[model samples]
Target: MKLNKILVYVIMILVLITSCKKDIVAGEVQDTEKKIECEEVEETPKEIVIDIDDIYNSVDIDIGYVELENLNEDNVPEIDLEYYPKDGDFILKKVSDGYICVSLEEYEDENALEDYLSPMVYRFNENGKLSWKKHYDYKTHVGKIGQVLTFDDDSFIFHIDSYQDWNEGRLINDNCYLIKCNKDGEEEWTKEYSNSNRDMLANILLSDSEEILIIGEWKAKDGKEYDDIDKGLKEELNNDIVITKLDAEGNMIEQKSFGGSNDEHVDIVGYDKKLGIIIEAISFSNDGPFAVDIIDKWNNDFIACIDEKNLEIKWIYRLVGGKYTTNNRFSINNGMVYMIVTQNNRNRQHSQSLITIDDKGNASKLITQTYDQMVDKFNSLMILQNGDIVIGEGNQYISSLRIFDDTGKVKKVIHDINLVPDEIIPTDDGGFIVKSRRQIKTVPQPIYVSCIWYDTELVMMKYDSNYNIEWRKTYDRYKNNPYWDCVIPLNNGKQITEIKTDYRKSCID
Candidate 1:
């Protein structure tokens, strides 16, 4: 009887041990499954995660901000005052006085100018100080003046018209001119262009022969009188590509016009110094309207033309397929041209396109990247040394920074640059600085450019080549000022900023 009892006890003890071992094994299996799920979910886009390094203190340089008078001093936010507005175009130039001149296209007013946005010029001193400013308008046009080119130490030149036709050709008084102004915003001289019904200078840069090449458009009737656009108005629509060349002393050297009764425009132009030719690209229509929202008409093509002093085309090649929204820049290398365009799929508003132009000016789609990435409208892109392309703006995809190879492959996905890219300057060493934004919340959140969300204090940061934060500077959005000018790196670790009359520096330890 004693032996039988002892056996029963041993059996019960063995059973209990087995049960406990099974429970331990189950817990281990469950933990393994959980870890696998996390790894799979990480494949998601970076846009969903808040970067760990986005809002950190700077280490290298201290940021500075300042405000100047002669600006709108109303109920305005700090960041938005000097920040660039939507569709806000910019031109960074070095003046003879060693001052950096940054120009931003005028923005739309809530009051709509009631007509159109007028062009306002903000000037900065050599030390990145905001000096005097001015607003210009035409007697008839609905908007203000546009970008100005620094000609000499005391004066600059800009383009505008009295008839603000909103890209429509104007007649009689509809003309484009290069107006010269002194440092105090005083008018010095105005060089006008006529014969072409209407026109506006889109951009101006130095030419091969050390001349000033102005890229713009001019419109005239095929004698059809543009009856197509009557629309009950007596005026007609004259669409043409008008290019005017000027000498170093500000004299008109030549002018040329292109288009066929239909609509055409030239967005940019440059002088091929090595080839000793003036090259300009203009879009012309062979067919009528387009069915695709992203592309122009089916028959529309971009022609690369090289001309002589006689204003005649020497060689021309018509590039096909691409749409008009492509803000492409052409570079002439060793007997080849590099044409890069910022493109996206028809399904979304943002994407990337990089094309290589052969010696014959033919476009080969070298690399393309398209995904479910959402980005702000006015982003900036620069070509890297290794032939990679870097883009900056508001990224809606995974993380923040995306490095792409020439074959459309993503080399790196940076959720946080540790700094925002306010301006992306492609360095020779193959890195970039991000001028990003930061803010302080006050009021009901004021309107902002570069971002749709409103904020009071906007922080502009700098990033290194490896996406490291170099420095971050914060500025106050002012009431009257509605645009952020430009942020430049200074010699000292401390940087200088030119906000609307409020120039101050920040200490980043």
Candidate 2:
């Protein structure tokens, strides 16, 4: 009986050992399955490689006026013109489809001597094909379209200066209009603001909440009566700055004006929901210099911050100097304002200086770079995400782009003889897109005789993180009129620019 009981106990122990071995194998299998599942869940994103050759080859150079004429296609519609249509102002914004361009156009009136200006907006597909176009015209009034702001929903808002005069040549009325349109270029709503003062639209800003901010200059209606040599001209005119806010549906929520004695013209430099609005203005001096021969000159250049909610000035900083040219460029980044200002002397020699302003509106000069040899102008100024300031300075022939450190010292200079950089923008990959004009001439003349004498091309350059030129491509559609070229970068590492014809004849003979 004892031997039988011991054998039973041994059988039970063997059964227990077999169960333990099965549980261990199941746990290992479960862990391996979990590892496999995790490996399937995570994925590495694919990198987008842009084919430079493909993009270059896709350019439609035959779409311009001259090319269309050469084709003798009557189906093509005439593009509207503004004054010098070839030199019209344009604003470009990237959309999902591609790019939307809003341009100011002036049309020649067969009955009248002066041409009437209007606004035209065009939509293009991802491959740069024209999808649709919307042209706005107020039969009698001339329109000067200023800027366009696009929303996430693919809708856009554009502002224009609308004015009309009596047949007797006396000014009747002038007004500003804001028009909102849908993705199809159909007008959703239009708002017109009529003020006793003459107002000019400067720029449109998009807020963090997707609201619209209209910035402009306002001059008293009485100011138009004063002559150039009038002693009380500055006192008579109430030149001020105007700021207006609009909701998503084109409703004005708030409007405010700020100014003091002396003629003041304000420009909206930057704005943020948290930091409010930043503006730069110039106040003309009344007593300093006055003559019929002399034109308008500024006495004080000031920068100010305004509260977004209250519309009250938070702080004001001023830099006193001689005449301040319109080439002033300023940008705001990380609570700091960077500016490039040109001060003109009595001899018409201009000197450019770089300065910075803190959140408190305290102004400090970074470095004063003078251009005594030729007419040096600041074409573009941009602050990188890493706090570096890049400035493009150029004359008619040569151009240089200088990268300045955070402390305002020149870190490096990128120079080219024939390239005139008109604009520079930062890319997501820590590089830059330089929109420049390349002029090729036979001799090193101070000035090219005519558009026909020289070959000109619009250049788009891509730079690496180390500021090395990766590749560059040029377009010769509007070879002579580089001023009309507007290059906008796309999210997919592509670009779109204006294409026109060089209609002017060459004076080579």
Best by TM-score: 2
> Native-vs-model 2 lDDT?
0.62
Model 2 alpha-carbon drift over 4 Å, by segment = 1-90, 103-120, 134-141, 163-175, 195-200, 220-237, 284-298, 321-326, 342-352, 368-379, 394-398, 409-411, 438-456, 478-492, 497-509
Residue-by-residue lDDT tens digits, candidate 2, 153-199? 89998877666667566775656677899989889998876634335
- Candidate 2: the clashing residue pairs are 81-105, 81-106, 82-106
What TM-score, computed on C-alpha atoms, does each candidate reach?
A: 0.54, 0.65
Tens digits of lDDT, candidate 1, 1-509: 44334434654655565566767886897799887775433333233222212211211111222221222223211221343223334344456543433333434456553434444566665554556566655323332244556655556676664453444453334555566677677777777644243344666666545567766665455423333345454344556665667876678888665555456766556555443343435444553221112235433445454553665555454444444324445545443444545544477554555555554555676555554434343245555656665655353221265666656577776664333344555544456544544422211111232322223344444445665545544455453232343344432222334444454222111
Error of 1 at 3 (Å): 79
Candidate 1 global CA lDDT score: 0.48
TM-score between candidate 2 and the true structure: 0.65
Q: State the displacement of the C-alpha of residue 404, model 1, in Å, after optimal TM-score superposition.
A: 6.0
